[model samples]
Target: MENEDIWPPKCPECGSPKVDYERQSEYTGGGYADYWDEFQCRKCEFTWRSDKKTSYF
Candidate 1:
């Protein structure tokens, strides 16, 4: 894997750079897939993190 960004990274959205980060469960049903660092933009609802580095929700 590549070097991942640290917590409180810039928001991929709005680009406001104001971001909120938290640890959340990342399992669907089976065993724990992994923990994720969820990030939310202060401006928009656009949220993402280490878990969805390629997409946004």
Candidate 2:
């Protein structure tokens, strides 16, 4: 695995940098509530979720 693969989340089917953030949701019913972010690939139309929250503060 290269450094780029270990960093940004890429489409598993097609490797493309044309990725877009879909939306964000909060899960409060789980054990530990967390904010998740959704992403989609413009080239392949692949979608994925990430739990790494971002703080603007």
Candidate 3:
């Protein structure tokens, strides 16, 4: 399960409006970094950070 507090409404990288939740890996038994809310930028290829500060956004 994922905590809502750890997700971001927008991407902090390129500041694009295009953002969504995604899994880093599709394979099972993956590490923590394998599962995260990925943000896609429409203007650039910059992705959001999955760190602690991401929740603050």
TM-score, per-candidate, Cα-based: 0.53, 0.55, 0.37
Per residue, candidate 3 scores C-alpha lDDT tens digits across 1-57 of 966564445556666656665655433433322334466666676766453321111
* Model 1 Cα lDDT, one tens digit per residue, 1-57: 854564577767566777888876545444434566878887887888675322222
Clashing pairs counted in every model: 0, 0, 0
| Model 2 CA lDDT for position 47 | 88
Which candidate has the top score in lDDT? Answer: 2
Candidate 1, lDDT over the whole model: 0.66
A best-first ranking of the candidates according to their TM-score comes to 2, 1, 3
Worst 10 residues of 1 by lDDT: 48-57
Residues 21-45, model 2: lDDT tens digits: 7556455553544566687899989
Relative to the true structure, candidate 1 reaches a TM of 0.53
Between 1 and 2, whose lDDT is larger?
Answer: 2
